[model samples]
Target: MSKKTEFQALDLISAYSEKKKNPSHLELNQIFPNPTQPRLIGREDTADLVPSMERLGLIEPILVRKDKGKYLIVAGERRYRAAIKLGWKEIPAIVTDANEDVCYEMSLAENEKRKNLNPWEVGKAIQYLRKEKRKTAEEVSELLGYSGRYVKQLSSIARLDQKSVMELMISGKPLSVKNLEELLKRKENRGGETISPRPGSGSGRISINLSKLNGRVRDNFLKELGLLKKKYGINE
Candidate 1:
């Protein structure tokens, strides 16, 4: 087997071992939502999933970790909720001994199985991997199947103020990376300054023409930019 396959098998074995020790069943009261879950599941989305679950039953078990006397969901929240909606007494679950980092990673990976995660959700997951797990952009790109360029862009979006991020989440509008980059640029410029370079227009938006700088100055500026990024923990 490939190294990745081997690692995944080991993880399966570990989870199975933990389940044997815990022997959990997903009783309604016993299962809790993950406190740190970043993705939101609207009732509309769950409405569709409920029918499939009713017809086929749960094809996969939800993953959970022990919390005090209860089990907190590590993955498969939609399945858990659908089962509850159908008034099912219990559902299958695998209780694992995964730590906080592993739990977060597992939840992220599980959500990605359908590749339906929102851009904000993707950004948050990448942020967790970068900041919490201390992974590089390349590492996150490989783990999450995002392009290297897009991963850096997502990382930048994650660094925005939490209030702005919260506002975006509340808007519930689909996010485009291009739009997010534009938002970031305006935020950095302060007061939503216009960034377009139009003829016979003035908006007090600062514009830099790199060609105006001498080679040495440009090189030095690039070096300084790198240093600033490193200092501020910006990824690119």
Candidate 2:
């Protein structure tokens, strides 16, 4: 929920908007996960979701694609996992004929909507699209609702390694995007003697993500925090 970059969202995979098909009860054994799932970079804990599912029973159906007589999860792997853990033999799903590319986009969009994806994980995915020229700068800008320059700036972070991404994921922490970007910039321009955004580094700064909050709520929260910071003589 890192505030959606403000894209006019389209149902790329039609998972949410597909009106032609009703949810089908698919056997848990039949669905396999998409191997290239971007989530593989920083798999999240679906433990919290499990209890909710157990109590309420899946509130939303998962999205899946049928391929080669097997169902591949386009998104909602977390829901599927919870269902598995609950010992359910079958789960409800909306089956779509999304191909590999559409599946990837839908997975990214769904995870993003959940606000669970690490910023770096998103950067890597953007970089992958750019490197392959599958998406141009304009297309990316339109898709993300970010300016071309900003998208390029964000994508530059993909140069960072998976270790850092994993560390953030493990700690459930968000780092200052600007700080990380500046560090990367310096690394490229000035073969920095020591480049680290982890605690040991002097430049390290933690960030609070407000994307999941409603816009007005996040604004009010930030305003209150600013007042508190001023009252406490806190420095940026």
Distance from true location, Cα of 27 in model 2, Å: 0.9
Off by over 4 Å in 1: 1-24, 40-45, 133-148, 160-174, 187-236
Using TM-score, give the best candidate's number.
2
List, residue by residue over 31-102, the lDDT tens digit for candidate 1.
988877757534125887899999998877778889899988877788888888999999888877878777
In order, candidate lDDTs are 0.67, 0.70
Each candidate's TM vs. the true structure?
A: 0.62, 0.69
What pairs collide in candidate 1? none
Worst 10 residues of 1 by lDDT: 1-10
| Local accuracy of candidate 2 as per-residue lDDT tens digits, 1-236 | 33344334345744366543467999999998787666755354678888999899887888888998999998888888888888999998988766777677777777767765665667777886677647887787777666665666568777877765556546765554655565566657844222223354545455789889998999998999788567545578
